[model samples]
Target: MADIARRPFLRHLRAETTSYVQHLRNGEVRHAGAGIAFWFRPATAALAEVPLDDREQTLLFHARTADFQDVTVQATVSVRAVEPALAATRIDFGIDPRTGRWRAAPLEVLGGLLTELAQQPALDLLATLGMAEALARGLAPVRDRIAEALAADPRLAERGLAVTDVRVVAIRTDPEVERALQTETRERVQQEADRATYERRAVAVERERAIAENELANQIELARR
Candidate 1:
């Protein structure tokens, strides 16, 4: 009876040791707090879904990272998961896990997306009527390319993973560009004002000339009478 009791304890210890070894091998052990999946929209942020089995608990992680920087800007995203397991794999590898299921694919896709985003002209980003719409428009080509690439990846297609949104969270303009735009606007306004004033003065002068000619004609008629 004592041996049986001791066996359970010994087995538990062995399991713990094995888990620790696996953790060390994995480099970082992501406790399954909540299984998360990511859905990256073509022109918006990445949406993370949690509870790999259920679509409801999915959380979106709006990821925005600046060019040439290691830091990422993340917001709480709102999206649903089409493939829970795939989404979970994306979150684990893309955000936290060093060696996750989609490790290579996520990095490749995200890196390409970020690089393409960075290459976009600042003016294009600012000149658009709506930031989100503009970003979506801009990302059309990139999205097509990404889709093709993902289709080529057997693993991603098998999981039914898709990127849904990719949008501009915020736009940053150069100070010089802003100042130049302001100056141009002011100059244009001043030009319009000057033109209006000149037109008014010309009209006044023309009216005065017409009145003077009428007066002269009346004087001539009176003198002749």
Candidate 2:
């Protein structure tokens, strides 16, 4: 919704339900709250808007495993601003009263911070595991590690941000490496199958030999009788 209406020299501003707005005049806060409506002089008013709704950020990055193999990590992180006042102070959420648009990209700055925090723990964990181990068991452990780091980081709390959830979707190696592993597995399976077939044929030949010997013994006894 268009929250700003212009009439004469005064601009009426109404904040969105998901947004928390802070209005300041003469270096003092005049109004501060969510979904607030007020009128102010554009030249004398300073405005800041912080989003209170939860947002999900997708992250994709590469890391090296213990075996010196490179792998890609895909993850999603859910976050929200808890304190509008603190968040505004930490980042440039200031907007022009006349245009009602932010003077800076605050969300991009937050996303960059989150990406750095999430990547650190994940990279540390992957560096300790081999490629196969990372692919097999790295997802949950990486997710937990990132979650713990984000939750415990003082910077996030100071900025009035909270990490609601962390999910690691996949840990994958290079395509050529994956294909090589698959080929090795397929060869092992084929060898086992061949061995089983040989054993079954040997058992059938032994049974036939025993049956022929029993028939020859019976014929000899009948001739003697």
> Per-residue lDDT for 160 in model 1?
40
lDDT of 1 by residue, 1-225 (tens): 000112221211111211111111133332222322222221222222232221211111222223321112221111233554454444443221221222234434434433443333322322433433333243454334433443345553444444444333323234564466568779999999999999999999999999999999999999999
Residue-level lDDT of model 2, residues 43-131, one tens digit each, is: 89989999899978888899999989999999999999998899988988898887889988888888889999989899999999998
RMSD of each: 14.0, 3.3
Candidate 2 TM-score, true structure as reference:
0.83
List the pairs of residues colliding in candidate 2: none
Error of 2 at 94 (Å): 1.7
